[model samples]
Target chain A: MIDEIIGLYNYWVVIFLMMTGFYVVIASTNLVKKIIGLNIFQTSVFILYITMGKVADGTAPILEEGITSYSNPLPHVLILTAIVVGVATTAVGLALVVRIKEAYDTIEEDEIHDQDDSL
Target chain B: MDNLAVIQVLLPLLSAPLCLLFNKARLAWMIAVVVSWAALFVSLSLLVMVNDNGPIIYEQGGWPAPIGIVYHVDILTAFVLLIVTSIAAVVMPYAGKSVEKEIPVSKQPAFFSALLLCMAGLLGIVSTGDAFNVFVFLEISSLATYALLSQGKDRRSLTSTFQYLIMGTIGGTFILIGIGLIYMKTGTLNMADLADRLPAVFDSRTVHASFAFLTVGICLKLALFPLHLWLPNAYTYAPSVVTIFVAATSTKVAVYMLLRFSFTVFGVDLVFAKLPLTEVLLPLAIVGILVGSLAAIKQSNIKRMLAYSSVAQIGYMILGISFVSASGLTGGILHLFNHAIIKAALFMALGAVAYQIGSTHIDALKGLAKKMPWTFAGFAIGGLSIIGVPLTAGFVSKWYLVLAAIEKEWWIVVAVLLVGSLLAVIYIWRVVEVAYFQTADDESDIQVKEAPLQLLIPLWILVIANIYFGINTSLTVESASSAATMLLGANS
Candidate 1:
C-alpha cells in the first residue's frame, strides 16, 4: 500500500496544482490574476508531461558510448512546443486586458459587467 | 494525389504571409479571394479522390506513421474540408466590403492575413492525424480568432474577446493535460497507434480521467450547453464578417474533433458501452436543445438570437451522437455540414443588414424586406432551414435524427426534437414578421439601398446551396453514412 502511494505521488502533485490553478481562474475577478492563474494551470500541465517522461537511472536522451538507458525525449519536445503556445496565449490574453482596461477603465470583471449592463 | 491534402492546408498558410507583403487593401483582398478559391478547388479535388479511392495518408518528411506527422484525409476530413473551404471562399468577397466599412483602412491588409491564418489553422486541425498536432493547430486558430473578435466596433468586443481568451486557454490546457495523460499510458501520439494500444488500458482510471478531461475541455471550446457562456457575446459583438466565418466553421470543427476522438481514438465500445457518456450526453443535449431554443426566443438582437440558435443546432448534432447508432452518427455528421451552410448564409445576411442600418436589433429590421429584398430573401430561406422545414437542408439531417431516435425507441428525445423545431419557428417568425409586415418607424431609413454585389452574391450562393443540398442528398448523405460506418467499423 505504501509503495502504491509512493509510486503515484507525482500525479497527486500534478492534480493538486491543476485544481488550485483552475480554482484561482474561476474564483478571481481581477483580469490579471485570472491570466496568472491560466499560466499556472498551463505550467502544471507542462510539469505533468515532463514528470511522465522521467525514467529511473536513465541518462540524458543523447546517445553515448556505453549508455543504452535514456529518458524518453518525445514528451520533453512536445512540452517545449506547448510552452511556446502558452506564451502566445499569455501575450494575447494580456493584450486583450490592456484593450479592456482602455475601454472600460477598469479590469475587474464585476465592474466591467456593471458598466456593460448600464449601457 | 497524396500531396493534395498537404496543399489544401499549405495553400492558405503560404498565402497569409504573402498577404502581409501587399500595401494596398485591394491587392490584399484580391490575394485573399484568389487563395481561398484555390483552397476550395483543392478541397473539391480531395473530396473526389477520397470518394473514389479511399483515405489519403501523407506522411511528413517521408517518415513512417509512428514517428512522423501524417495528414489523413478520409471521407470525414474531406467532408469537413469542403465545408470550411467553401465558407472561406464565400465569406472572402463579403469580407472585403464589410471590412472596408467596419475596420480602418490601414488595418484591412492585416485583417486579411489574420483571416487566412484562421482558415489554415482550422484546415490543419481537421486534416492532421497526430494528437499533439491538433493542439498546435487549435491554438493557431484560437489566437487568430481572438484577434478577429477584438476588431469589432463595439468596445464590448474587447471584453468579450478577453472572456473567450480566458475560457479558450483553460479549455486548451485541459486538452493538453488529457493528451499528456494518454501519452503517458500509451507512449504514442499518433492517433491510429493510440487506438491500437488503448484497449489494453481501457480499464485504467487514468484513461477514464483523460476521457473526462478531453470531453469537458472540448465541450467548453465548442460551447456545448452549460459550457456555452462565452459563445453568445463572442458572436454578438464580433465584426459581422468574423462571426460569419467562426460561427460556421470553428465549433463544427470542434464537433469533428470530438467525434474523431470518441470514435477513432477511444473506440465505440469503450466510449459508448463501457462508459456512461451517452447517459450524460443525452440529458445535457436535450436540455441544451430546449434551453437554447427558449433563450433564443427572448433575444431582441438578431445576432444574439441566432447565436443562441446555434447552441440549439449544436444540441441536435450532439443528440444524434448520443444515440450511438449508424443512423445517429450519420445524422450528426450531416448536421455538421448542413448547419455550416445555413448559419453562414443567415449571418452573412445579418451582416448585410448591419452594414446598411448599423444595427442588428430586431426593430432595425422593420420593413427591411422592402429595401433589402434579396438580403431578406436570404435570411428567410436560411431561417426556414433552421426551422427544419421540408425541402430544405435542415430537414434532411433532422429527419435522420428523428429516425435514429426512433431506432433507439427514445420517445423523449423525439419530443424534444419536435419542440426545438417549434421554438425555432417562433423565433424565426418573429424576424420574418418584423421584416415583412411592419412599416419602418423612421421613413428615411427605408430608402437605404441594397447591399453591394460582392456581399449579395456570396449570400445567395450559400442560400442556394441550402436548397440545392436539400434536394440533392447524393453527396452529403452518402459521405456521412460512409464516414459513420468507417468510424463505427474501425473500432469493432
Candidate 2:
C-alpha cells in the first residue's frame, strides 16, 4: 500500500500541474500568463519523464571518480533535450507576446479578439 | 558514402546559426537562398539515389542502431524531402522582399535564421530513424513556428500564438509520453528496431496505450478535423510568408510522420486490425471534408477561407487512406504532394496580394484580376486545381480517390468527394467573380499593377508544375502508388 501510494503520487502531481496549466491558459486574459501556463504544462511533462527514469537508490549516470549504480540515463538525456526545447519554446512564446502587446496595447485575449472584430 | 546521408539534414542545421552571425540583410538572403537551394539539390540527389538503390541508413557518430542515434532515408523520406526542400527553394526568394517589408529590418536576420532552422528541424524530424530525435526536431520546428506566427501585426497574433503554444505543448507532451511508453516496452528508440521488436509485445496493454497516445497526439499535431481548432487562426493571423511556409509544409510534415508511425513503426496490422482506427478516422475525415468546405464558404477573409479549405483537403488525403487499398494509398500520397503545391501556390498568390494591398479581405481583391493579372491568373489556376478540374493536379488526386472508392463499392464516399469539389467551385468562383467581374472600388486603384517579376516567377512556376504534373504524372503516380503499396503491405 505504501509503494502504491508512492507510485501514484508522481502521476497525481503530473495531473495536477497539467490541469492547473491548462486552466490558466483557458482562464487567463493576459498573453504572458498564457505563456506561463504553457511553461507549467511543459514542465509537468518533464517531471513525468524524470519520474519514469527514477530507479530505487540509483545514482546519476556519470563516469566520475566513483559511481557504480546509475538511474536510466536515456530518459534523463531525452528530458534534457526536452528542457532545451522547452526553453526555446518559452523564449519564442514570450517574443510573440511582446509583439502582441506592441500591436494591440493589451495582452488580454478577449481584447485582441474584440479589436480584430472591429477591424 | 553511407555517412554522407547525415549531411542531408546537418548542412542546413549548421547554416541556421551562421545566419544569426551575419548582420547584413543581403548577405543573409544570399546565404539563406543558397542553403535552401543546396537542400533542394540534396533532396533531388537523395531521391535519385533512393530510386537507383534502396533505403540508406546512417548510424550517428560511428555507432550502431539500438545503441546509438540513427538516420534513415527510405523512399518515403526522400519523397517528403523533395516536397519540403523544393517549396523552401521557391519561398526563399519571395521571402527576400516579403520579409523585408513585413518583419522589421533589425529582426530580419534572426527571422531568416529561424526560418532556416525551422526547415532543418522539419527535415531532421522526417529523416531521423530515432524516435526521441523525432520529438526533439518536432519541438525545434514548433518553437520556430511560434516565432514565425507571432510576426503578424496584430496583438491577436500573440493570443493565437499562445493558443498554439498551449495546444502544441500538450500535443508534444502527449507525443513524448507515447515515445517513452514505447521505449519502456521495447527498450529501443531506433525505429527499425522498434518495428522488429513490437510484434513480440503487440498484445501488451502498455503498447496499445502507447499507440493510442501517439495516434491522438499526432492527429492533434496534424490538425485532423476534430483536433484542428488551432490551425485556422494560426494560419489566418500569421505573417503572409509564415502562412505560406506553415500552411504548405508544417502540418504536411506532421501527416508524413503519422504515416511513418502508422505504416512503418507500428505496422499496418497493428494499427488497422486491432484498433478501430479506420472507422474512427474515416468518419472524422468525412466530417472534416464537408464541414471544412462549409466553414470556408462562410469566411469573408480569403486567407481564412483558404485555411479552412486546407482542413477539407487534409480530410481528402485522410479519406484516401481509409479505403486501405493500393489505389487508396496512392490517392492519399498523391494528394499530399498535390495539396502541398496547390496550397503553396494559392498562399503565395495571396502573399503577393498582401504585399501590394496590405490586406487579404475578399472585398479588397475586387478587380485584382484586371489590376494584378498574373497573380490572379495563378490564383485562378490554383482554384481550378482545388476544384479538381480535369488536367490539373487536384483532379489527378481526386480521380484516384474516387477510383479507390468505386473499387471498394463505397459510392457514398465518391459522392461526398464530388460534392466537396462542387463546394470548392462555389468558393473559388466567389474569388473569381470578385477578381474578374467586380468593378474596382477606386478607379485610381486600377493603375495598381501586377506583382513584381520576382513573385510572379515562383507563382507561375508552381502553376505550370501543377499543369505539367497533372498531365504527365509518371513520376508522381509511380512514387505515390509504390509508397501506397508499401504502406498497405507493411507487416502483411
Using Cα atoms, each model's DockQ against the true complex is 0.74, 0.58
lDDT of 1 by residue, A56-90 (tens): 98989998999989999999999999999999999
Interface RMS deviation of candidate 1: 1.6
Q: For model 2, how does the per-residue alpha-carbon lDDT over B1-492 read when each residue is reduced to its tens digit? A: 665567778877888788789776777778889999988988888888887898888988878988988899877788888888989999898888887668898888788888888898899998999999999989888888887887887556667777788788778878987898888888789998999999899899878888888888888888999998888988988888889888888888888888888889998888888888799889999999999999999899999999999999999988987787899889988898899899999999998998888889999988888889899999999999999999999999999999999999997898999999999998899999999999878877546778888888888999998898889999899888878877777678
Tens digits of per-residue lDDT for model 1 on B1-492? 799999999988888888788767888889999999999999999999999999999999898898999999999999999999999999998898888779898888888888999999999999999999999999999999999999999999998888899899988887898898899899999999999999999999999999998998899998999999899999999999999999999999999999999999999999999999899889989999999999999999999999999999999999988988999999999999999999999999999999988999998888889899999999999999999998899999999999999998999899999999999999999999999999999886447889988889999999999999899999999999999999989899
True contacts kept of 1: 0.85
Q: How many backbone clashes does candidate 2 have?
A: 0
Report the Cα lDDT for residue B313, model 1. 92
Per-residue lDDT, model 1, residue A102, is 92
Task: Name the DockQ score for candidate 2.
Answer: 0.58
What's the distance in Å from true for residue B81, model 2? 0.4
After superposition, the stretches of candidate 2 with alpha carbons farther than 4 Å from their true spots are: A1-3, A56-70
The C-alpha RMSD in Å for every predicted model, in order, reads 1.3, 2.1
Interface RMSD (Cα, Å) for model 2: 2.5
Judge candidate 1 against the unseen true structure and give its global Cα lDDT, from 0 to 1. Answer: 0.93
lDDT at position B416, candidate 1: 95
- The estimated TM-scores of all candidates read 0.98, 0.95
